[model samples]
Target: MTTTRSLVVPLPDTTATCQARRRLDELVKPVGSLGRLEELAAWLCGAHGTVPPRPLDDVRVAVFAGDHGVSAAPPGAPGVSAYPRELTAAMVRVFQAGTSGVTVLAREVGARVRVLDIAVDAELDDVARDVVARKVRRGSGAIDVEDALTPGEAEQAFSVGRAVADEEVDAGADLLIPGDMGIGNSTVAAALVGASLGLPAHRVVGTGTGVDETGHAHKVAVVERALHRVEGRVADPFDRLTALGSACAAATAGFLVQAAVRSTPVVLDGVFSLAAALVARDIAPDAARWWLAGHRSTEPAQSVALTALGLEPILDLGLRLGEGSGAVQAVPVLRAARAVLADMGSLADLT
Candidate 1:
């Protein structure tokens, strides 16, 4: 992540984290018997400033949908995705219809899904106002040849994300998940992370959406071109985002920044979310304390980014599908952490 202005994001409550660990150890079970569950519980405690974090009663996921210019080519071409570009808009409608994979999984975990059209190529005016109200442009520019977004569009996307986080937190969402929905967004994510971490294009590219070896190589070449375009020129996180990230990525980064400012805990989803998180962390170093690496994707760039942020994945399910599915899958595990802290009996209870 590029070093920028460190926002006044506060660290989690240390007293609460200590109390939570002590309480967990004093439980009726053996010390540390719960393994990582205890660690998750303690992190939640620090996030909420309480020994027993309030149950994750309200979980909200904001999927930022946009289209990439690099993906303008058809399938099997450089910078293009296996899926068609129309899938971005089609998936938005599917998400609103509650029939998407993420929606169904969200239902099982008692979480809510909200889709935002940040830079979708099509006019989603027919969708809910809340979703399309923040559209900065139709689609982002081809990063391989031009900046992904203009300076104005990048700023607007970031503002939209910050506003959405406030709206969710004000609506009583205790936990937030930022997901991505854009064709070829994986390429955009990799390019941004490659720029942020000063890595070569080959090191950051990954086969998103089940690409074959040839397709993966094509993606790598495309990302390499984009990274070369901005190498040694953009050092600020925001500048890197404008150079290499999609509209949805900038929005996700903004959403992450505001969540930390609001002291809301977040479960990061996939390479897309982690890519944004790396940028967000650069803007606010302390914001890392409020985020949990929801799951690890198969992307090599994701592991590198997560390690750079000092976050360990809660689950390594080999999940690559974005739209916050993996993060929501780990929500039940977090809920269990709260349950263990709130319901598991202690020796005092036995007495």
Candidate 2:
């Protein structure tokens, strides 16, 4: 596996991207007729460092599961997620049993699914054996009152992500999908997005897991408090993540950075993944070159992150599922994009 003591994001192959764009124009379809698919094909070429990219046959989805200390709040308490913290561990079991939405969609798209136990708060015996263990901590601290992680713990989480990316790439994964499963993670995501993009907490916060108006208001307040606590102290992306992001977000960012360094493409899920991507982009500005936004999550923070990253989502089905379900839904679209480049005849050949 490739090791990076500190993440060094690599630049994409622009020459390959140009070559692929020319090839797309020469296809039987009119120039730009295929819209985003053509762009996706060209992007694939850039990411793979080839004119006509290989099929994304070796696709893998890594769902990093953790818990947020903020989730420890009772249902009626401020900053609580709609679901209990135990749901984090329970959902890992669901993923392990191949019963989750991500599992079904990965199966549909011929992608392999691996659940990573990043930092779930509870002890999970049955699901523990099936997951890739890389727990950075028991769970992240409540950001509303304190830093989510110490700088060292944040770095450790980032290293965990980078290691996961290296392992997947070395194991023959050409394409990666990042998913997150941590109750109250959206709160963390909102805080990170708000801090990174200079947006207000109210604008970034959303009703995670179908929170009612009262819960939504409470979440927003929590995010505002977190942002206030970290104001003027987030000197860089790493600091921002350490201050406001969850363990899962830090790991996801690290995973994304390493994937780009290895020249592997990644499909990003919802707001949590986007929050991580924002931090990764700050760490390595060129890392965005390897990522494709899989969908537009209903979460407001997702839009902020996508806008900041300049990524247009392939799907916009109002999806807010966090277990990489939205990214899995986008796999078929990427496969179809690849097919357009691989199977379509050139205009000359058609004539």
Candidate 3:
């Protein structure tokens, strides 16, 4: 498959960022008093190429849904996911009904939600008419034994993501949030992060979806085996993604790259999204400029990925849910930062 080098992502303008900082310093409040809020506003100025960045009025969250072949493990299997693969399709329905955590939070933040069925295994019934139907395959192959997708399939998944990002941008979405909802995705995410950072599985794996102690141990072992299979072979980001073997993650990474190409800011959620971000960064180093770590997840790999990317989470609520819940929670903070920059009077005006 071709790498993302062909895609041109513009770097944030440092001159505009400096101007934004200067303007913030002149606000009525004390210099640096707003803490991270001031920093976020300046970063927005750099991203949007405006001294006073526009408010994130039209935020959109795109939740990519898929299934993992590993999720089909037998009942007595050692490394089976806690939830059934059927939940992947069921949750997509929930998202469409506007009753899922992501929908509720999107409503609270005034952001629109789009559920993209990138590669769910089962045929979904009663799905909303608007859900993007870009299924690459029934699901990804088992990563522990074989590559998740052939080179062509991997590229197709990336195209699905890029198309979705383009569509959203065309619809006037200024800010983007990428989310994941696939059974066994956390296991795939842990393996991807562990392999990319050269960390052991025990260090990066976490108890996903309330797995028991035995299930957690099994998960770690599964990750270990998968990483061992792909170790020393993941010379590039695309290789790492194929090694990890997740369609949803590949799509999310693609979406992230496309959003950055469009100069749209992204708030990434949890380990799955962070794992994709790691791959996206490898594909396009400057893509990191348009992303913010929405929240720190309980999963250990999240910290590893965020630290490697030089991003600090805006919120740390011990959130482990992956339906973009944590990222949506941080939207208000971005809004508040933009509001401060746009609405606050200058010290000269106050005097």
Candidate 4:
């Protein structure tokens, strides 16, 4: 009973992929000497439907920021997250200011960043107008005891994601990266993966933000409770999203789906993006074809979701940062792959 949507996700271009493989075989280096780089080049060629794959000059990293109610607690009391809830909005401002790690990394890779205020609890008055214009609500309800978003809000966030993809693609974004920003997003993201894979809380939960053993146990209990509440609707992707995920996650799902639909490639960050992409893949069927797991995350849910998607991460830096920093780090790897395909000397050149 997955959330069946009216959408058609196209497969990658086999002709271009085969062409890339053939050309890769002719590279002056030993056959397959480039190893995964060869595979990556072929993937790029397939995704772009071009023999050598076009340059990824206009890479856009979209950070979806939102607040999760599961992070709420009584005054002076702690909750699922180690950081204060207000940091979500603060980081959004940091992203807009172009000072965060994500911004720095994106700039180094010849890309740009866009920060969207999907559901941060704060007013974010200091942030740029365009950054906060897409707020879905003040924050999501606590998934441990209440629904994260209403049906309408879930759809709205998803639609916002699709619109963002369309906006970026229409504006000539050759590649897209969807990042996550929230205090307790890892918890919700793990829950999304659990629902998609029918796993228990212990199997899905992880030590997000270096929570202590006590904090880890509490987080597991909280996710367990949330899973219990959604047991009946686990089969419905949107229902699971509405009950256990946040506006950011839903928007990410939409963003990934629309990127695939538009035949644009995407680099997924960590577990946050993985969970959302899991739901996106379920809804759109073959959307995973347009994605690359940017890096391996410390979270087990990240590996779980990657395995489910049949995607192998490009890097394994143990990055737990969720601001799309990990994916941005892989931009250079993509550049290297594209370089080998576009610039490397071929055996035919020697002839």
State the displacement of the C-alpha of residue 256, model 1, in Å, after optimal TM-score superposition: 0.4
What is the C-alpha lDDT profile of model 1 across 1-351, one tens digit per residue? Answer: 222234568889999999999999988999998999999999999999997899898999999999988888854454457888889999999999999989999999999999999999998878789777888788988998999888766667887888899899999999999988999888988888898899998898888887788889888888888888888887887788888887899899989998998999999989999999998887777888899998999998899999999889999999999999999999999999999999989988788
Residue-level lDDT tens digits of model 4 in 236-290: 6777789998889989999999999899999999999999999888778889889
State candidate 1's TM-score: 0.96
Q: In candidate 4, which residue ranges exceed 4 Å CA deviation?
A: 1-6, 75-78
| Number of backbone collisions per candidate | 0, 0, 0, 0
lDDT of 2 by residue, 128-178 (tens): 564645877788889988888876777788888888998999999979999
Name the runs in model 1 displaced over 4 angstroms: 1-7, 74-79, 349-351
Query: How do all models score by TM-score?
Result: 0.96, 0.95, 0.96, 0.96
* Model 2, backbone clash pairs (residues 3+ apart or across chains), number: 0
Supply the TM-score for candidate 2.
Answer: 0.95
Model 3 C-alpha lDDT per residue in residues 241-292, reported as the tens digit of each score: 7767577888899999999999899999999999999888888888899999
Q: Go through the candidates in order and give each one's C-alpha lDDT.
A: 0.88, 0.86, 0.87, 0.90
Clashes of 4: 0
lDDT-wise, the better of 2 and 4 is: 4
1 versus 4: better TM-score goes to: 4
